[model samples]
Target: MQVSAGQAKLGADQITEAERGLLDFVTIEDGLGPQSSRRHEPDERTDQVRGRLDAVLIASRVAPLTRHIGLVPTVVATHTEPFHISKAIATLDYVSAGRAGLRVRISARPDEAAHFGRRTIRRTDAPDGGQPITELFDEAADYVEVVRRLWDSWEDDAEIRDAATGRFIDRDKLHYIDFEGRFFSVKGPSITPRPPQGQPLVTALAHQTVPYRLVARQADIGYVTPHDADQARAIVAEIRAEQQAAGRAGEPLHVFGDLVVLLDDSEAAARARLDRLDTLAGEPYNSDTRVFTGTAEQLADLLEELATGGLTGFRLRPAVTGHDLPRVTGDLVPELQRRRRFRTAYDATTLRGLLGLTRPANRYATTAA
Candidate 1:
């Protein structure tokens, strides 16, 4: 029953309340855009100001109000510079005292590109005119690879203090990644020191091979939406295999199942509420995986069933964040705690600890020759 919130009018109070209740963490969705290239959704807030509120600002606001809750911000990698992202995430890690994470998402539509004053990038049409969108995602995967290396460019002990000698850093400890790639290139150590967490967590969602491969290599956790238990296992297997192929099998990479939840006291009441919410949304609430609607106990049982797929955990997207988020924190968490499936109180303060993830060793750490 670990909770995460998104960028909706769902009020920051809901997030604060959830944190007060000791739910795992609150994630604010910062990435914003239109549905398609042609239509613009009606927005009361100015687009320029609103778009900046995406995960970065939201996480910043949430960080100070609550002390222990993990603050994960969604940072879209498609149109952003890797150098800038490296600094921003590092700063977030400092602000939150190492309780920050980044949800690395790849954009799919063209409208988001126009906001950055760049020509729309089409995944389907290749620069060579032969490859498809699949190839473009492969390129994006490489792009993320660059970001990961940049984040790890400076070793943990790179900073030094020698008062009499007047030296503040060990230059030799700083290493240049000198990463060269198809889409972009990066050189040398990060301007910022290694994050407080050594390497803050990076998570990405994947529905296809390219993303799966990217998750296997670049992400600490990979989110997958599978309709059935068997599909979840297959996806995990694929990611594990990719991890081995990429020489990253030693890292603790978690495959978390994603679900859209609508929980209530009874089955009938849950259905009625879901139906009502769908009507409000103006379309039937459909997920690639069938939505889960029932009591919190039933939802917990379903979560346990899904856990058999060797998943680290589940990320439930509530049908209505305002209403359902509270239910998740109040009802579902208590049940999980009773079963010893989740922590009654945060055993550790960092995001990695809350997720039961280990602080990844600095990539530059190696045995002496």
Candidate 2:
């Protein structure tokens, strides 16, 4: 939200404070072009901040400013090249010293599609139904696949920089990744070598079976919106089934609940704040995800309850970033720590390490046994 208001420094300050608060990670969602509507089409409402800063660039800018906290920026896969994304994120990994990850998303808005002019997206490609939506998600899956393969195209030991031997790189370590899919085709090695973590974390937000399959097939983390614990449990179960069907049940995947929160010192104050915001915006607070209005302790209690439903963690969207983000980092985090439910110190340095994900082996590597 700070970035939306063109306050880049404030946004960086918030993230640094979040790191000091010991939060695991922060995701900067991009609105390359946006509509405030749920469909993501253009809307006439001008009350909200409509300006968008590129998510990756913002993360890269903030990389050297903070340490330990993971920087996960949103990148829309639609109309984007997998090779470019792979290079950008790989560079981000280097800039952040291995604390970078990305949440890959797909844009269906005709307005957003108009930006690249690569292809026209009809309104029929809506999120509700049709083969078009499935095709988009499938393409997104392929995009992730290509990005992953390209990350491994240059093996871990490809860069030798051996000036003594006049050899800067091991050419034999580079491998061609010939990937052909229904949506895209790419040949040869990526210009960027394997990232520090081998592969940075891949994530997506899944609401149904199609997107769930994408999450199962590729994502290291799946963000889900569930209104209640029962729904959370069911969603987790469904994603787990999809994982098994995708033949990736053996791999560890974290399912994180997504919530929109308006936090305060008291539950009443929180509700009042939400009501005020809604009144100013001239619309009731509405969202696809659950809305939480409560004290930090209450929010923490809710989180603990939801975690029992199989959610490994949560991604809370602050209704007002300036207010609620501070509440989350200062108040809610301490309450969780007091309950001995949260970490008082960062447990790991890298984003993958923080998430308990082991660094993946570069598939193209042929090391001696």
Candidate 3:
């Protein structure tokens, strides 16, 4: 995942370069504020990411310049309106010719909640505390619910751009999605028509049980942080259990391990590179995802080992985007290709197609029939 701010042309250029490497997809990470190491507050730390561009808009800007790779942008579900996001991502799917997806994220911080004055997210420490873990996760689930419902509100072929007849659309094909949940309610047929991909791919990143349940219920792919193969296995097992519990055992859910990588020609060199970076930054860089400093071969070995633990794929975050992103596209991808783990050529045009997901039938269409 990459977040490039400032200019759409610059972001488009970066994405175009990534696409040339035949990578399956690229994610645009979006944030409401400067994301800090501190989960809740904005920081004065200069080393951290201080700014980011709108992920969906960046994906849209790059859409026309590239082909084959998936463009998935993260959207904060907590504060944003689901109705608007559904239409936005649906438009992205059309603009990208079905190579579009979205990553749903929650903003639970008071600082973040302040951006939207309509609600206040009280801290657990506060006298009248705000959202509990369950409340926040449940709200996110409802957000996804509304988005998915709106995606299915209009049946495929609802638009009839007829010249001979005076018809613009088949009104019967559009259905109201009257969704009333604890957090919010939506009345739809989205303003935008059904996307090219019936329901554009919905993805989320999960660390614990609540989020795991969200992944099982709503997401096509769940990005998980697991340090080792055993941990990966445990996470996958728990998510699988959740999926079954949610009565979605028969549906496909891809669990991808997220890792930060600093790769070089050799392990020693990679370590040295990271050491230099940490030295420059004045502290050792650490995150929820383990930072693997090694060659592409070693990374491949790690991925293969992790896959055995039921992780279908891995989402490697480059330690330094400009430096490590190229190694991933140039070095790591080819290594996987040689082992038959990665595709050599572009096999599918649409993001869902590449992932082997069949275009789902509209729920409204089926209900009407």
Candidate 4:
């Protein structure tokens, strides 16, 4: 029942402050432009601007400023090289002392292709002779799997010091993951040592089978959108089945239901607020899943109901970030704690701890016979 703030166009400090309160996780959007829309303006320069206000810089600042908040910055695996991201997340873990997570994003838009001078990758349905977009998504899953392996190429105790013998590291503790996939090839051992958390955290959104496979086999957390409680249970069950098939049933793979929330003290007031916002925007905002428009208490109950159906948590999208995030952190969190559903104070310092997850073993560590 812990809350988190998804990416919003707010100052870094305000965002960090909100997480410091009762919110346990903070996801910072990195390098994502507006979704593909025919009428959207040309964003040739937006990419540069995004790189300027880099998510890593924001995370570094947020990590030190807040004690127990989980700082997860998005890393686009398609356009950005894994080498850079590995170092960045490792550095973030060092600075944050293991409070780092990553929202693994794959570039799905064709316009984004221009930024890298790569051909516009099309989804499965495109007329271009390219492989189906679905297949590309599968490739993306492979890409993240490779990144995960690279993150674990070095054991937690790989770095050793023996000034007397002039030895600085135990080479046996270092591993080569030499991973090659249909989309990319990566040679072993990460430039940086294993992150402070061993492997920090990797998460992704799964709207289809491709991502579901990735989430089942790779991610520590998976963000999923389901229509109702029944659908939520079904999705969770399917992912659990997939995990068993992939030999990852022993790992704690959290599935959080994704929702867009508009809260008020009364149900009528919340509905009116959502209606007014949609009217202000001059269009009906039809989301992929149902929107929760009610009091925080009512929303909390719905979350609990959904939880019973198998979801471990919820990722709320505020109708308007500036307006609703404060309510979520200030209002909803207290209500949940009052019910003894959410944590009152952080019981642990690390992000993994906040989530009730242990620091995982280094993947390179294998028992010798």
- Find the candidate with the highest lDDT and give its number: 2
In model 1, the Cα lDDT at residue 53 comes to: 48
Residue-wise lDDT of candidate 3 within 1-369, one digit each (tens)? 111111112366567767776776777888777777777887788765577778899889889888887888999988899999999999999999999899998887777778777466754545575666567778999999999999999899899989899898999999899998898878887999999999899988899998999999999999999989899999999999999999999998888888888889999999999889889888888777888999999988988888888998777777777778778888888888898888777888888888888899898885535
Cα-based TM-score, every candidate: 0.87, 0.94, 0.94, 0.89
Q: Is candidate 2 or candidate 4 better by TM-score?
A: 2
Q: Report the C-alpha lDDT of model 1 over 1-369, residue by residue, as the tens digit.
A: 344433334346876876755766655665557332123233453322343345677777767777787777778777787788887888888888988888887765555666776545555564754335565566667766776677678778878888999998888778788888877788857788888887778887788788898899788878888877778888899999999999998878888888888888998999999888777656686665558889999988888877777777777777777778888888988888899887777678788887777777767766579
Clashes of 3: 1
Name the TM-score of candidate 4: 0.89
Better of 1 and 2 by TM-score: 2
TM-score of 2: 0.94
By TM-score, is 3 or 4 better? 3
Please write out the lDDT profile of model 2 over residues 38-107, one tens digit for every residue: 5757778776666777889999999999988888888889978999999999999999999988999888
Better structure of 1 and 4 per lDDT: 4
How many residue pairs clash in all the candidates, one count each?
4, 0, 1, 3
lDDT of each: 0.74, 0.84, 0.83, 0.78
Name the 10 consecutive residues with the lowest summed lDDT in model 1: 34-43
- Model 2, which residues run further than 4 Å from truth? 1-10, 122-131
lDDT (0-100) at residue 83 of candidate 1?
A: 80
